[model samples]
Target: MPGFPAAGPPGGPQRSSAETYAQVQASPEFAALRRRWRGFIFPVSALFLIWFLAYVLLSAYAPGIVNTRVGGSNITVGLLFGLLQFVSTFAIATIYSRFAEKELDPEASRLRAEVEDSL
Candidate 1:
């Protein structure tokens, strides 16, 4: 145990090893998940933040864009957004796929194996 590296804090990312391990002990799956998915989470969060803010801004100040009609059958501008919403979700899934298969899954799997081996 002396040679094994410690973990960090739970709830969120922290600078200390104790904090990280506290997190690992609390959620064994997340310990490895955090390592693999951390990279994806940050940028994804930022993108979501920007996306949310854009949606808020559009809904608030850009009502015209939200209500613009596309077809004679009374297509609202927001209806177009439903399509974008699906696109965005799919895009995020795609991004996660690349990250998971390429980096996160492998690292997490390796760490998980290491942890299991220790047990």
Candidate 2:
């Protein structure tokens, strides 16, 4: 509530929901928003899945590499990699948050306001 924009007026023109939605869907702005979402989501999802799959495969089929000690430390390669998974997850979340804030939210807010004002 503190950070988000205030809502528009409650009452608006009495139009069919389908008509409003169709109008919005037909807008180029909506198309660009969808494209931006997919552009970020698809590649990030693919990369994370690949990384996870590699970790799983390594753990199952190549224990020697996964279990190897790092330097004189007690930490194993598997442990490091496992820890890195969490780090990467947080990093990606931060990146996405920044990206959405910078590139997506403003456009989405504009679209939302436009729809609300029309409604």
Tell me, by lDDT, which candidate is best.
2
Regions of candidate 2 where Cα sits further than 4 Å from its true position: 1-13
Residue 39 Cα positional deviation in candidate 1, in Å, after optimal superposition:
2.7
* Cα lDDT over the full model 1: 0.67
Model 1: which ten-residue window has the lowest total lDDT?
Answer: 1-10
lDDT of each: 0.67, 0.84
For 9-56, candidate 2 gives per-residue lDDT tens digits of 458446665666678788888899999999999999899999999999
lDDT of 1 by residue, 54-103 (tens): 87688789999988888765877777776676788888889888878987
Best TM-score among the predictions, by candidate number = 2
Show the lowest summed lDDT stretch of 10 residues, model 2.
1-10
Model 2 alpha-carbon miss at residue 78, Å: 0.3
RMSD of 1: 9.0
